[model samples]
Target: MVVLMRRRLVWALAFVLVLSLTGQEDTAKKPARTISIVAERFFFSPSKIKVKEGETVEFVLTSDDTDHGFHVPAAGIDVAIPPSGKGEARVRFTAIKKGNFRFECSRACGAGHNLMRGEIIVR
Candidate 1:
């Protein structure tokens, strides 16, 4: 009877351990995020994104015509948008600073290369 009780205790402990580990893994996984942004000849359709002070933003930037690049200086993100193609990018940051940050395409697209700009407003 004593040996049987010991074995049951061990199994219970093992089950608890497995449950704890599995719960942790689920919490660690990030939430699903999908944000669509339009990229035109020389600008981002939304032009600006408004986000809470601390939030993870998944930006899906797509080009309407030609290929372009998306760059955010403060967030340190650079993504290239293919012509008639779509791309995905993510940025996670705490809006420690409350202001408007600039985002532009690093790549030279055309005559309007200097006009490719966007903004990220954190409040």
Candidate 2:
């Protein structure tokens, strides 16, 4: 009877440890906010983005049909998104004044290379 009680106690302690570990894992896996940007033939979807001041945003950039690059000139951020492959970048900035920031694909695309531009409005 003593041996059986000890076995039960061991199992209960193990179960509690497992539950504590799981709770910690859940807290560590909290999701981060994301902003999706699609790069297609020659344009950036939405053409403009609006983001809150001082918010950390994960930019999930994807290219649809061809290889492309996402470059923010003002921020000096450049990341290439391969065709059909997902890429990610991040930006967090505080806005003291309202203005438009220009962004474009630095990579030389086809005829519309110069036209591939977008803006970010911060307020």
lDDT of candidate 1 over 1-123, digit per residue (tens): 999678556645644554354345344444345467878788888998887665545566677887677787886566666556333333333344778989898778899988989888989
TM-score of each: 0.66, 0.64
RMSD of each: 16.5, 15.9
Candidate 1: worst 10 consecutive residues by lDDT?
85-94
Error of 2 at 77 (Å): 0.4
**Model 2 misplaced regions, further than 4 Å:** 1-32, 85-97
Candidate 1 residue 108 Cα shift, in angstroms, is: 1.0
On the 0 to 100 scale, the lDDT of residue 69 in model 1 is 76
- Going through the candidates in order, what is the number of backbone clashes in each? 0, 0
**How does each model score on lDDT?**
0.66, 0.63
